[model samples]
Target: MSEKIIFAGTPDFAAEHLKALIEAKYNIIAVYTQPDRPSGRGHKLTPSPVKSLALEHNIPVFTPVNFKEEADKAQFESLQADLAVVVAYGLILPERILNAPRLGCINVHGSLLPQWRGAAPIQRALLSGQDKTGVTIMQIVKELDAGDMLYKKEIEITTQDTSGTLFERLASCGAQALVEAMPKILAQELVPQKQDSALVTYAQKLSKDESPLNFNHSAKQLSLQVRGLNPWPVATTTFDEVVYKVFLAQELSAEQVALLGKIDDLENGAIVQVSSEGITVKCAEGCLLLQTIQAPGKGRVSAGDFARSKKDLFVRGKCFA
Candidate 1:
């Protein structure tokens, strides 16, 4: 527990782990996070959540663009840290930097090892409709999240989970898992298990291009898309040439299955019904209920509220492009 530690991360997820280590009273010698970037309406440079948290603790913070520079690499080595803990650090570390620490580095990844190993694991897991996913504490190999596993804590992927919600849960899960693994790692009691290459699956970064909702897909698939993209590049639909962001969505209930059968021949994406509850849009195989939506330059509102404000647009037989 006296080992000098270097904490590296960027987002709120990483901040959570940093907070855990601090609360556990670990010797966090320094912190590493991405450089401040322009954010929000004014585009002012904003510190990452990790940086802010570290600063609050009066911890020395490093924001090197990368270890590509000799000075940056040397600065890291000068610390002579026993271990480096990385989580959602954004920057890909070089092998030299990874080896700078005496005990090398370990990553708290947001996925079960050998699968969903990339930048957007939580979102990809939901998008793929996985029944369960988990966090993995692994060695920091040169390859992208292709490290040997140290420990894993699996959790169920509930039907109600969105990437945003999963982010919060996984951050907490990963934080506890990391803190639990640290002592064993320092004591050399933990064994590393090699990953199964055959079972590997990557979760590529989410894209704005992937945000558009396509009614051509089944309602179930569309529902996944909506959940996966929530809180970032939200699932969108074109209505009257305006882009409307979709938040909450659902497939028809067992009783409502009869309703879809009635309009089994109607054009997909056409409005089936608009009630006080939501706007039902027919899909390729079934109907999807749009529960919440957001218009350009406006706050998110329930689908029923949007319908009331734009009654003409939600009229039956009208199509959403």
Candidate 2:
């Protein structure tokens, strides 16, 4: 028999998992997602992806402003759910709600836990230059992502993987892992191991003010930062007192490094030269080749186009703030 599950989630990533569960024929009794909030440039209020998916499946959805309220808690417990699945739910589940389900709550986290255990796992992993990271299905406890692992799947960190890309892959992988873990979870055959508190690392939520690219960091570190923050709050820097976003970049190749010799020792964001490939800029420890960039009030363009558009900005000794 399928377990009577209560699903809770908010973003598209979470919705993917919910869809997988529903497609697998799980008896989803209800869904709980955060209340709608203003979004997009127009700031229109829209239902969360999870809510939309639940509505399509003919499952009831609850958008509680306060989970602690008597009505909200009563409504949740009334489902008498056998289990609860949560992914990026945005709202905290109190002890009563956590223990209400017969099999307790399970969460799909985007990082290898005991590390990056908070609001921005995907971004943190990429920013830290982690060569490998992946999803972890765990038994949810009261603490933040401090749960026992039920399943995990690792993925390689390619030189080009951004937080946005990594998130999509992890979300899909998590859905598969969650579906497979459900059977063991229902049969009571899964073992829950305790996480080591001493080794914990937190992934604090990112903010718009954090997008400025610091050239004082090493080439690899700066590159990772740019990639992690891309597509939202993208890394920005000032050139000729005008802010420009670094859309794509990488460490300079040996050929380009030879061409940029000696001049590469200049201060941060100093454009050494523009070769056939791209423009070389000095970083704290090495050099970065700007592949794509966007000038203030302009759309993104290749380094060659940007250099051509603003010749003075790409001069040999000019530094970007």
Candidate 3:
């Protein structure tokens, strides 16, 4: 018989693992996800991706705000699940709920444990210019993401990878890793390994304050920031009292750097040049080629196209704060 599993998670990342379990016929008895929240321009209540998938498969779902309540704890224990799998579950599971399942709880974390041990691991990895990251399946403990690891799989982080793209790749990777580890988990053949305390790194959640572009940073760092925050809280700068969001950027070439040096009295954030290649902006250490940008109330457009239509706005010497 298949193992009786209790699944808990939210967001698209979590939903992917739940979907994989269903396809694998793991006998999911119930799913726990965050409560529906108002979303989009209309502010309509929208169910989480996990909840939507659970209902489609006719699986029972719970959205308890927390397990602190005695009733909620009792109901969870009543499930009598052999194992519990968590992936990006927003809520913290108290000790009572954590020990409810016979095999205890296992988490499918986005980053290799002890590296990025908190929220927003994928974005953190890209923002820090990490060349690679991976997923880890671990036994959840009291501390956050401090669980002992059972399995792991690594993947490369390409220069072109944004948080959105990396998220999709890691989600799929986590699903496959979890599925492959299931047989060993069922037989208790896998030995969990303790993480090194000295190697622990935290990925605090992203905030609006992190979205603004600071030209004082090197061109390479700024480029990573732009890509890391893409599709959410995008990197922005002030131009003529309006916010200009930067979606894509790259470091300028040596030739471009030489051209920038020729321009006198140019400050960081100043528009150095605009051409078919892109819009070059001066930075503290180097120049950045802005590939895609968006003005307030406007859709994203190529820097070249935007420069053509708004020549007066992007003229050389005009500065962005």
The positional error of residue 82 in candidate 3, measured at the CA in angstroms, is: 1.0
| Residue 201 lDDT (model 2) | 93
Q: How high a TM-score does candidate 2 get? A: 0.95
Residue pairs with colliding backbones in model 2 are: none
Clash statistics: count for each candidate = 0, 0, 0
Number of the top TM-score candidate = 1
Selected candidate, larger lDDT, 1 vs 3: 1
Instruction: Choose 1 or 2, whichever is better by TM-score.
Output: 1
> In model 3, which runs have C-alpha deviations exceeding 4 angstroms?
255-265
Answer with 1 or 3, whichever has the higher TM-score. 1
lDDT of each: 0.92, 0.86, 0.91
Cα lDDT tens digits for candidate 1, 87-188: 999898999999999989999999997989888999999999998988999999898888889999989998899999999999999999988888999987
lDDT of 3: 0.91
RMSD each, Å: 1.5, 1.7, 1.7
